[model samples]
Target: MKAYAVLVPGLAASAPADADVRAFTETYEYSTQPEGTTSVQLWHTARRVTWDEDYAEEFEHRIEIKHGVSEHWDVATSTVLVQSGRNGLTLDRVVLGPRYRFADRAEWPVDVTLALEAGKVADRSIYPLELRVVAARDIDSLTLAANGIVGVQVGADVIDEVDLAIGWAAGASYQLHNKLRIGAETWGGTADEGPRPPTDGVNASVGPVVHVAPSSKLWVTGTAGFGLTDNADVVAV
Candidate 1:
């Protein structure tokens, strides 16, 4: 489940027409909120995992607030809560992300954005840092987007060395109406183990996405993801 609330109604009103249409739930788009506008988003996800004879369900909730600093830059902060199996929900992490776009849409073949994120996990000494390159293009009413991501852990606990992880997400969506859109998305990631070829294991999923913007201040996006590898959850929503 997801929701979007714009705080500065006047600024949002003057934004571009497509600014409020989010094509993919898991894919990052190239557009940022209008300058001086703030938007709040809430997200919830649940996944089913099975291993041998054991099965478990995991749930996560996140709330994020994003503010546009300029036409090219936006910053966001989020808090995560998670529950696994029979355990009660607990605070998982806090994250801060800042994104910047290179130029106006259609100025180049594809719009490009750079995103940097940092997070502190609960009870973990290490802090995680992630960098992503987001690229997107609009072809008439259809939109295509992709993201390349790299992440590493830092802090006193990782003073010796750090391993890198690589991931990617891509999606394509077409607007069906002023308030509805549909898309498909796929994402996968691999972690590097010490001295090993980065192929230790992989987690991947692919699924269909639906986005509904009932109004300028409220929007919902949902996806039903199926695992593509042994390491991924059996099903996710």
Candidate 2:
């Protein structure tokens, strides 16, 4: 008879991960657009975790806001709440991060970004620092992108190493119309701990993604992931 606290992130599916790109595992999009740009997005994520041999469910609601400080700098903030079988409803985590894009920003076929994030959950705080690289090329009506991600975490009750995670994501999308696109993405991450291989405790998932833009300023995106590893949650939507 044991229990674990489920922690979820407060971020939109389109939240930027790097200079430019979006994947199921992470976003490689730039931190800032142009100097006077701002946007907000609301997202919902449902996750199911297996406890012992049984299943437990959790739901998260996230509200994220981003503001561009300059052409190469942008800041983002998010707040999230989770409802779980054991905790009922409670604050999950709050995250604030800044991103810096190098070279030609999002238009570069290969772009790089440095991001720093701090999160607070309960009485514990964690900071994650990451370097993300994105390479994308357009082939006719289709776009293909690949991302390489590496990050480290430090804080109380968390890992304090320099290389805590190594992950990658690949995406292919077809533009069906002026306002719509459909794609599939796969992402995987491995934790660096103990003597196991880099992917020993890996959490891997893959699913389809859709993006819709009804107007210039409004966008809607959704994706679902099915776990491919025993360590991963069964399903996420």
- RMSD value for candidate 1: 3.4
lDDT string, candidate 2, 1-237, tens digits = 001111123322343423222322233443344344566667777777444435457788777776668777778788877886576777778888777777663376655666666667656656655556756666776767677877677776674444378887777778898678788887777853222244458877788887666654555667787778776656777
The positional error of residue 145 in candidate 1, measured at the CA in angstroms, is: 0.3
lDDT (Cα) of model 2: 0.62
Cα lDDT tens digits for candidate 1, 123-147: 8787889999999999998999999
In lDDT terms, how accurate is model 1? 0.80
Give the runs in model 1 whose Cα sits over 4 Å from its true position: 1-21, 51-53, 156-160, 192-199
Best by lDDT: 1
Highest TM-score model number: 1
TM-score between model 2 and native: 0.75
Clashes of 1: 0
lDDT for position 183 in model 1: 86
Which lDDT values do the candidates have, in the order given? 0.80, 0.62
TM-score of 1: 0.89
- C-alpha TM-scores of all predictions: 0.89, 0.75
